[model samples]
Target: MKEIPEFQTERLFLRGITLEDTSSYQKHFVDYEVVRYLADHVPWPYPENGIEEFLKEYILPNQAMSLWMWGIFLKEKPTEVIGAIELCRKGKPENRGFWLGRKFWGKGLMTEAVAPITDYAFTKLGFEKLIFANAVGNIGSRRVKEKSGAKLIGTEPAKFVDPKFTEHELWELTKEDWSKP
Candidate 1:
């Protein structure tokens, strides 16, 4: 079995998800405010069985692929998971997804965590571009993507269960855009 790599940023440690972090992660997932803007699949009142399903079926089997889901920890409290970030493979390019507890919002922590991972995707992983998207009214998330240099491409109307929603905006960034000197 392959071991997932751990990464360090200026203020956060991006480490692989362990069996230990299930509870902490569930705390954030259960918050309606947090999952509101996420993809249609991440159900609100996140299923009690969801975390285990994620670990055994989704995360463990996909360990070999470029896709990885990480638990984001504060540098001072390295073992405590405060949020999550994942680089998901979406056909030709990769997609970026993240969430921080409501308390950590507006602190530039997400931006700090995203930059190195953005660099890792284009530089180390040999990917040409990265993509991000959020529900149309989700300005905070859009700001994080923009801060990382992703351009607003267009808006698309889509459907999601769980919370039962629709409509979203799309954004994207190329490695070339991020690599400019």
Candidate 2:
């Protein structure tokens, strides 16, 4: 298995997910506020073992292959995964997806977490461009992509845990446009 390297930002650390993170993952991720923004495929009444099942089935197996995921942690609370970010080689319309705990929202933490991952995608993974999407009214997520210089492409019908979100916005960022620091 290709080990996802551990890295850090000014206020956060990023590392691979583990079964041991199940408790913190469930605590932060199972809330309706968080899950509501996700693709409709995520069960609304999250299963009791959702975190464990996801780690084993979706995240762990693909972590070293077609997908890469990182458990986002605060510098102070290094052990708790407050959020997650992922990149996939194949675009199911978009190559990136992410979520931050509601308590930690509006602090630009997700934006901070996205930087190194985007760098890893273009530089390490050799992606020429990346596609991103979010439910149409999800301004927070859209802002992260916009702040990183991604252009708004268009919108398309999409399903989300929040049924009111009937469409999603698409954005694109090419290697030539990525401003790496």
* Candidate achieving the largest lDDT: 2
Q: What C-alpha lDDT do the candidate models reach, one value each?
A: 0.76, 0.91
Task: Give candidate 1 misplaced runs (Cα > 4 Å).
Answer: 91-94, 160-165, 179-181
What TM-score would each prediction reach against the true structure?
Answer: 0.89, 0.97
lDDT of 2 at 130: 99
Error of 2 at 63 (Å): 1.1
Clashes of each: 0, 0
Q: Write the per-residue lDDT of candidate 2 for residues 51-96, one digit (tens) a residue.
A: 8998998899888689999999999999999999989999998999
In the predicted model 2, the residue pairs found to clash are none
What's the distance in Å from true for residue 98, model 2?
Answer: 0.3
Q: Alpha-carbon error at 181 in model 1, in Å?
A: 13
Q: Candidate 1 has which clashing residue pairs, if any?
A: none
